[model samples]
Target chain A: MQGKTGSESWQEVWDKSVNGPRALIDCWQEIPCDPCQEACAQGSIVLSSGICAPPALHAETCNGCGKCVAICPGMAIFLVDRSIGSGLARVTVPYEMRDEIRLGGEAWAVDGEGNYLAEGRITRVSGAGRPGRTMLLTIEVPEEWALKVRGVRGRRKLLEEPEEVEAIEAVEDFAFCRCEEIDYSRLREIITQGEFRSLPALRRFSRAGLGYCQGRFCQSILRSQFLADCPEEDREVESFRVRAPVRPVKLSRLGGEDG
Target chain B: MSLPCEQLDLLVIGAGPAGLCAAYEAAAVGCRVTIVDENDKAGGQLSKQIHRFFGSSHHGAGKRGIEIAEELFGDCLKLGVDVRLSSSVLGLFSNGEVMIDAPTQLCLVNPGAVIVATGASEKSLAFPGWTLPGVMGAGAAQTLINIHRILPGSRVLMVGSGNVGLIVSYQLLQAGAEVVGVVDTAGSISGYQVHAGRVRREGIPVYLGHRLLSARGSTGLEEVLVEAIEDGTVKRFEADVLCLAVGMSPLCDLAAMRDCRMVYEDALGGLVPWHGADMRTSQSPVYIAGDASGVEEASVAMEEGRIAGISAAEDLGSLNSGEAAERRAAIAKRLDELRAGPHSRGKLAAKERLYAR
Candidate 1:
């Protein structure tokens, strides 16, 4: 069994890829989740580290059950069988879109990143006409391309690819601080004139981060702007200064006086 | 006249997912809990989320966020937690004094312990004509569409391909608004591929490696100019609404006001109050959880809430040490699982630095 402390290695995953039909989980990220384990009645899926651990399958125990396929919130689980006669593989994927999915039809198969891969024949479609549910689509693909096909989409006209052009200069002056109406031009001038090294210095000189929102909106923007122009050595120490009364309070309130 | 300062055992601020879960855990342990929020309603941003959440069943995965918020709030109420809505905590003093502006009166609270779950706010991107009426945060448009049942505009241009941008774009389409396209500066999709696929299936082109240069109109937003960052190719789309889903920053103002040690963590949405694994800040009586602690999934926030809540309860002698440790271990493991994903490496490291005393 693969230990929970370490992620599943290729050998462990390969060992579980049995000859018959089995579930293939494409989930690589350690998303803290485990509904797939609960969905498997045969106890085929092992979650040694509770819900957050990725589901580990025992090849011998899995019965090609598709319960885990529909329940995965990420829709990363798939059912595949490469040994089903006729040089072809059957791959089942979850579909949640509202498009019309038909059986005995052709669809464009896509890779894990949603890029168009190859065309596959749709053999079966389940859970249609149900609202708020995941539909499973089984497609027949070339045995060589079975592992790569993640999902299928209808043949739609793709937008023209963006063309290459010369680098453009920064556009017209835009406000950096909305509450104070401090635009970018004014910020650049202040940064040079005041020789502001930190956010507090700039805030003290320009009143850019002293608005009602308490620099929540402007601080990040200002930091990005400063870092883009500042020397590399001074970049690490540049950040906003946090102070009290995070919310706007009347002076009377601070004095403990009744409103 | 101002009401005299009231001494309480525990006070939780911002009755969102984290705060609600915190209140529930502490109150379940037979500790008196009083929760306050600025909004008239208890669910903070959870009420505006129409998309189904993703996590284990314990985090309400597969359930819509709105449903989870209702369930969490309901659980807190059933436990007899005192919930004050439209009651904003004006200021949190260094001495543990909390000044609250209730709907009817001004009150001061001196609590034995405080849990700050104030959550995070949407980060905005500025461009020409960005201040136009139709140019707004994606969350604002989501609130308008999902909560208020009003479409922000007819044709929308979404900037940022993160989960919020993708989900809100899908939601906009579901609400009968046309999503012109989604623009992002990154070459690859940043959010989950499943979410990106949902929009791609609908023929909504995701313009990757592109940055929004400007929004233009006479009065309201009418069009947006997007330029490819790689080669500077510019494209313009006619859009009445330009929704920015760039990112979010943790709402740590209250924590900062409490004189808690602060640190700059880019992964945690910039500056955040430093805290330990138990969710207690450097300040003895102050604790924090949820997005306010650091922006993560509501599921992670809920788990952190339980940790903070139980820690407070145990500190106040409401729970035994053995029981608190057991519960903490389970939650810590869950947190580890959540942060186990490769994408969370930076966040996990940032949290480690935060947890270091």
Candidate 2:
């Protein structure tokens, strides 16, 4: 119940537990799926009798065969080393989605809940498309944070070169203010410029909040980019403007069918 | 046991949206068609989904999903498609043969082509008191309210913010029940904004980043507990009905037991049989359509069934290949509209494994 997400399970991290090259193939769900069990060449995984039984990994007999990792559809399984030979344990989890990232870039690793913590380095990549094409991302970290580092941050070029302001080419439809036509493309231009490097600076240039919709759609979308463009002295962390009518509609006029 | 076989032009398993569509299309092409389903009624998921569907004109946009299913089933009947209800397909034999358990007899049917449209299975979530009697899937709740006109409970706590959870929350309100709120461990609502907004406007606070840590009840569900994902803080919310809308997975046991080509695609919901544009799987003549191939809305599932049916008819030489192509084009065109919108993107993403080529 509280132990797993869809098909991923929860295992408490033990600090004093002996560091081994072994890892438990964790599953959070019992989703009528058998790729992990079927994918296991070493006969490592077994499912209960029910159609939606969560798979239990036979830790004592598992041979570290990468077959199950390649075939798990949920990308929930991972390989971990409690401690590498040099005491720098490397944890490998699957990483997906496109990012402008490269090797050797410093990354802030996060846990299952996505809270950012200690930094790590990319160490290895496994099966691209053997059965499911899940990439085994090997990340090196402190032994204490080995079990906690489930994912890594992408796009560190900004941290590397603070003064650089690269031009953005492709654009999707996003308005700075729902009531106004302030396009995101224009907002980016104004915020990236030297004249408006901070939130207050960009606010002055765009008049983004100067609309009837208050600043619901526009403010938060601009917050991160605005903070990134601004100098360290002007960065103030704020959440997205959570507004009502949170959906688009004439609240006073309710135009949809009653049904 | 070695089962007997009866050869035919097309045989469809699960006479729901997919099977009905496939049977109607195949029969229209002058092919002998047979549709088998386990439920007492012919329409699989359709009989239960009382909500309106979204899509273009072809896919019955704005029409209740169940209505479209009825129309397809009617067309199947008009086309003289032999439909057998309460017929559970036991196993898939080698080639296109199938073993079925019908009332009073264990029958067999073998067609040149077959379509599997088993649809999806509701997921179960576990909490400290999850085994309580008041807990159920959102679909089960919908069935109780819409089909039987019975309120699940006086006050309920919905777990998961996916479309099912959100939609069911609103439906519960319509049925005169109090929905305290929805809790999801994920930070953002997993469903469409419209569905979430409707529930939100009703003052049902959707607690993103909250998990149902535990549930406590004596004989039935009386209280539930939620925990903040951020700080691990726990809070109690009194709930009589605890509905799980965590997610669903494609029911591919029938396909898998037959060794049909299958794969895992999050876009489609879960594990499903791999099929071609015509719905033919690795077993050359065997075809599958609807949710059995992958988890998708009824509109896409029907169109996929039709396309498979037409393709099978053409292959069986029951209709001109040119006629089959025309029907496929029209159905394919309709499927495109259903799968083109923002909502269909997930299904599109799920089928990316197929659409990539």
Candidate 3:
């Protein structure tokens, strides 16, 4: 709610809503998809900005339809109801785990970061439906933690700590071309020397783009390296010269000879 | 010994979703169809997809790609459509002659109509240390995990935020590998937010507006360095595998060899053959479908293949014009529906330009 979740932005909708329970479409990104909008039966979810726009919920019209919860491809949607009791609230979230969470079973409620928030009981577990593979799990939590709880712990752990990556001093020494095994340091040296006037000349000398893949993997990198080094006045980087055998054709097949 | 040459009603290339759909449609309508693919097994990349597809149920949505591929392949076999596996179409002549290289022998076939659906290849991204043995295409990683049952590495750094990157990263976790993070040069996540959400909920970080600068290792990929596009600040992470899901380009070499007019459309994944609404290329009696026409999902490719198959069948007089028009109209309407979303507007515009000429 404070940082990346952007759930605080929906405070106005939450404060103004008079409905008993409703769905919160927490999707913040404008990606080209509409399964959530289509999933709602009441047509409360709308994408006014075409297909790629983030879904906007018509709070009053939304009857807390859990349809959007299971259909969301990103699992970004959740249903929250804070007016249920004095301190009790219900939060329904999408679950794709293989092991199903049991109804009325004790489970650990986690926030967006998958950190332990509080222990809650699973109110309901919906089976796979029109939403295809995604299942819905509703958990009753403290009214204050309704917005904070996003998912539940299944048989497998929700989050795993990422491996530690040490900081390296230099990255330019790495290989740029995977197919031809051309390293960036070598290209940097070639560009600094200015011995070659064109990409074709550099390609001929280094054999960077002459791999089995026909330079599909490294031609762009070569061009970028040349552009990065060239002065603004001389910024024209020529394209790679492609030959007829764009795909790898066995020499024996071409010569009509068999092994 | 020289192989025997035979004439067929239709010859479909590539055996992918598009190719299989085209063969099935054409064969169902009583057009003698034969499909060929370079791989020892058919299904193309579909076999490696373990995630559920998005689309209406009519388009095989809600089904995993492997399931759809099995169903299509089963249908093709039941229809008695001749499927030649491990056979690559070596050459395509303007006269409708196709030279096929099979395991046993190299043979030539003259067909009344041809459907080119060679599909697309994964677009590569180059950075320092990208060529290390551990770094590979996201599709290759998918093939290794889902198909070959091999885990690529313990720690994976995905270089792209597109659907492939996001989906494969999740699959990596499912395969018991750790996904360090997903890095993209774009300012925002390019894939569906739901996919990003799934990864985020799993405690994986999605670094938008970050570019992978280089990979470092002695023999294989040992670490990857990424830079924030906005601030130019660099961060290094230990990753045994670097998956490149930058993008894909339509494999159009076969189409180009046949002298089909090629047009550059970035939206359709670069250098695509210009074709009409019927999927007929500039060359008559020759049609193109699936990624060869443009880069799109398997659902769109299947529909395009159906249209091409019906068009080819009509051209051979096996199907009447009236029936062909109805079928084409129905399939076209479904295609329009599938491409109606914001993500598909560019593809729609590209298709419009392709057919406009």
Candidate 4:
């Protein structure tokens, strides 16, 4: 390994944000793991070899179709938009939940490298899932704010800018689920998209909350986010479809020692 | 519950890193070693670790942990160490009687000493929509990726700032998915700064001091709701996946059930069975090594396993006291070195006290 400039290409990849759309994965590492290849519904990536070859990301083939997203275990990829258009590149990331203040609230946006850059108002809030885990709040910042805010600060004792943290604190609206990438804002979109209005019906079009682990981590959190948004309605799951495989099975279990 | 009545040979349980180490040590000197474990596989957590371990060469460093486990499995087989899997040792009877779940009729094993090496469990977070489909544990994420050769999710929101969380997040990036971001409840990154820095430099953000408030998306997880608090106030962010690396509590139930002397130490990651440098426990005849005693990394666990097994062999009269002492002194020095780095210091201290007893 060379220095930080070790391989100019590695740095270029990061600078260009050529890093994949998931977290913890490097399509660049020349190893072998192809689930990402199989995960892509649109054939955007390839894992041709056995499980040792690193996945190949084909730019033109990528439809921004989140199939690879659902299958990637590392969560290392992201749909980054370095192209600043209209002074702002809205990188529609996969957001899971919110803190409160449904209509539109303030958030201290952070860039991909954990730096605080700008302020923004919540633009859109969507909620879905059988139980409704996150109320995805799409905050609209200046076009430049797009790249500046890649992430949001989470549940630590925020000692910086006390007054601002307090303002958001008093707001109380959503939740975050580190799975399936669905939130209230997203759920609402799925419901309204004529993508099957009801919870179970929505399963066909959007596959809300349907993934490998089968929704164990974000189930309760989403329920509260749903009730928080709906309010006057009954706080029940209210007909959400329960996907199977709550516990992931080992390949050995699947093959049953037959292999 | 340990060795009583006639002094027997080496007694080992759980057959993972710690138990396997003890078995090998006892077998090296031909000390009738008997190993029992609840799982059919004896490698324990080693089978699940897909990545190369971080440490020096002596401790099997640079070798992928799974490979190390495979090697250990092979050694134990060749040594003729008695390993009974799916054989749950029901109790630690007063006179060395251990009830077990075996392939044949009910059985019992009485040995001169024992080694405990049960590992740790994945910690979970409380969040709305957390129970929705698509959500899983960080370990589960790794299991899906490295073992099953599958991707857990394309977009992920990882929680926890521990080494596992950070390292896994990095691995996730390697797997080619969008790491929505990392959400840690602590003010600072809990894992190695180097691990965190690598990913941070890669353009992933770490949301320290944040909590997962709730999550949405009906059939599965579509969004992640997170909030940060300062001066008793909260701020929020939303992301796709919710990976929690909060912390792990040591698995001490089996040891605890035996009524062995146990103590709680924050540095050790929770309560653990009492042991000493040689890996001997308060019960004298029983020895324990690795995370089961407390939550430490893999390197220390393996070294500790070696120490305990050697000591168990000597106790079984297989190895002379001088020989056991010589072997242990060497392994302990290496173990101490592995535990010397900044990351291992506090944990090493807590684990050292187990040996002190």
Best by TM-score: 1
* DockQ ranking from best candidate downward: 1, 3, 4, 2
- Residue ranges of candidate 1 with Cα displaced over 4 Å: A1-29, A44-66, A77-170, A211-216, A231-258
Looking only at chain B, model 2 earns a TM-score of 0.92
Worst 10 residues of 2 chain A by lDDT: A156-165
Q: Write the per-residue lDDT of candidate 1 for residues B7-124, one digit (tens) a residue.
A: 9989999898889988999999999999999988888888887666777777888767788889999999999999999888877987778989787767899999999999998887
Error of 2 at B289 (Å): 1.2
Task: Place model 2 in a CAPRI quality band.
Answer: incorrect
Q: How well is each residue in B95-169 modelled by candidate 4, as lDDT tens digits?
A: 555555455434456666877777776655544565566667787777677667787777777888787888788
> Sorted on TM-score, highest at the top, how do the candidates line up?
1, 3, 4, 2
Tens digits of per-residue lDDT, candidate 3, B141-238, equal: 99999889999899999988988999999899878898888999898878776677677766788888887777779999898888777877778788
Query: CA lDDT of A231 in candidate 2?
Result: 69
Better of 2 and 3 by TM-score: 3
DockQ of candidate 3 compared with the true complex: 0.23
Number of residue pairs clashing in candidate 1, backbone atoms closer than 3 angstroms, sequence gap of 3 or more or interchain? 1
Please list the Cα RMSD from the true structure of every candidate, rounded to 1 decimal place: 5.0, 25.2, 5.6, 18.8
Q: What does the interface RMSD come to for each candidate?
A: 4.4, 26.1, 4.8, 15.9
Q: How much is B70 displaced in model 3, in angstroms?
A: 3.1
TM-score of 2: 0.56
